[model samples]
Target: MRGLLPQLVMRVLAAGLLTVVVAAGWVLWDTARAARRDAQTTAALVSDAIAARPSFEGLAFGGVAPTPVFRDWQQFPAWSLIAPGICVELGPRDQPIQRRCGPYLAAATPPDWFVWLANRLGLVPEPVAVPVRTRYVSDAYVTAIADPGVIVTRAWARTGDLMRVAVGMAIGGAVLTGLLMIRLLAPFGLLLRGIEHLQRGDFTGRLPRLRVAEFDRLSSAVNDTAAALQEAQAARAELTRRLFSVQENERRALARELHDEFGQCLTATRAMAAAIAQSGESTAQDGARIAEISGQMMDSLRAELARLRPPDLDDLGLRPALERMVANWRARMPSVRFELGLAGPIDAVPDDLALSLYRIAQECVTNAIRHGTPTHIALHIEVGDAITLTAADDGSPRHGGTIDSGYGLLGIRERVDALGGSFVLAPVENGMRAVARLPL
Candidate 1:
């Protein structure tokens, strides 16, 4: 979501820029083409106007030169008011008379590049010759050169004006597009914030409905997922609480039975056997054997009870209990090297969390020894915003073949999940690694 806004903005800007560029190019091309056509039309009109003069008509029908009507027509000041771009020249074919209204001689003509561009686009008009008949001469004509630069320059000016308008339109369109994009993506921003909340474990947060149907549907889906996660978390927490209660009760009952019933009976039998051995001579050897057997049974029962629930975990705290557990494993498998790294305030961890972490570690070590046949094992625990436990072993990952599922891994996963944690078991360089993370 954080990245989405910038990405969308860039896309919109790119598309808008492309449209503006293409439209501007098209406008320029079309303007030049229309300006050329207008120049040609103006040139033709100027030629027609020159040919319509009465003097020119009489000359064409054989009227004599230097006549009064011809002189007046040639000297008419009204010719100066002819179409602005046309130059009227009055004279015989071989001799020049006078010229009027020419854009080339005008003071306000455009620059060379503008004229060149206009001329290239066929905007420069050509001369049109009108012939007149003289009684004494076979060939005589008046030439009108329409200086299309006047109309072409005006057309170019208009084109420039239209181009400015086009640019304005393009800028306005880009601005509007930006505003529209922001409006359309507003719902996505809301969705993004909601997703961020979910990532931070605030599953109670829900996305609001948006005006767009598609966005609304997406929001609804995200809300539904959050709701489901919230419910599932609650249910899992309850189930974990109940499971812990049941496990504690079972441990207490078993410990009580082993201590109050089995322990008392074994003690009484050992006392009787010791008395029998001390009192008699012939039965002494048999009594001694019985006493030894009963004493061994009591010691084994106590060890088993300790394994079920270590008293050190309750009285001495987690560190000692974990150290003792690891030491016992090292003693059992003297060939396997074990290393433990505990950082931060491990002793301050809650009893339940400590116990769960201990169990998970215990399972990982057991699995590594039995399946991985590891020669080296490393256990690392870090207590921070969350508890992270990592176990790595250097041994055959597959043992003799592919690893099979067992109650050990399943129990570890269930315990971690119950504590609202994640567990992963994967093959590492030499053997296997197990990692677990639990929120505080």
Candidate 2:
């Protein structure tokens, strides 16, 4: 579950630390090797200086008390150059007549482990001895010992500086690596936030541009998707409002038909029946009158039912239903020329789609006749890759063509939109045109 930023920082820290360790280790090894060589050379030089003294051999001859010839240890030329980390002594016995030591620690004091490691690795050179003899008999021995602990101490001191640098570099590298990763991955954060907005049904959210090519492309795609979704949401909201409005209108119209048409027709029929009964003889004329009244009531009922759903739409299919509607409209508006053009596979049209097309067409025709009062109304339906219905009229479109002018056209627009189609009502040169296109 580790994130990318953390992992990157760790790797960078490790790399920085490793580099420091390897470099520091090499330096330490090189220092150790040079220290060993320096110790040996110092020892040899010190011993040779001691041997070159004029009375050096005689001073330790016969192992007797100190003679007048023995000079103080500091008086000898050999005393001055007992280089650091070296020791010089006289005589072969366990106790030397004279002795001098170089610095016990020429560098910083080191830990016991450092010294042990130095000795183990042969970084501390071996002791050197030079015997000063008068003739065949040995007078004394001059010894130079590389017994001082300076090499390890010096190496350890240098290692301390390296460790500090290593620590600083590691920390700095980790911090810089983390910051860089966060900056580079900032786009991903924005993407997630955009997705959150989508989850909350807020398609309006947008993302900023990114410098990286891959991230920029991803951001662009997200922006495009969000724009599309926002548009779709707006459309859906509009469609829902239209649906409610249409439903309410249908309800009000149904109520009116029930109260004004059905109610009065029933009252008149009952009055006529009472009149016929009072006469005690239902004559042919009286029966004919009742039959006529019944026929009128039936027509009213059929009209009310058709307003909700046209019966022909289900039983006969889109083409035939539309044709019948045109015939009926022609009968109603005899003076107006009405044309219904049908093409493509109309019968195989899905029921829901057929209903939508039929309803929109019906609204267009009804609106034109009732409001526009056009002299000639042209309606066409064609189905190909998509279904298109265009209704135009030579009549005046000033009243009914404006979408905002009436609920009828609004309902038509809604139906087309619900079918994922386009609807437009605009005035052409001669008259107004309404076009609706729905995908198959």
Compare the candidates by lDDT and give the number of the best one. 2
Which digits, one per residue and each the tens of the lDDT, describe model 2 over residues 240-326?
656755775675578667767776777677577656756757474675577577767767777766666566776677887888889
User: What is the C-alpha local distance difference test score of candidate 2?
Assistant: 0.73
lDDT of 1 by residue, 1-440 (tens): 45655666566656766765576456546655544444344445443444454344555667775232344443445433344556666566568576656333334455678667767755554555565544433444556555565655665565566666766666676667668878888888899898998897789888877889999999999999899989988898779767876886688689878888999999999998999899878998889999999999998998887766776788899899889889988888899899999998999999888888887888788778877678899999999999999999988665332334524877777777778888888887888888999989
lDDT of each: 0.72, 0.73
TM-score of each: 0.58, 0.44
The local lDDT score (0 to 100) that residue 86 gets in candidate 2 is 63
What are the per-model numbers of colliding residue pairs? Answer: 1, 1
Model 2, residue 155: C-alpha shift (Å): 2.6
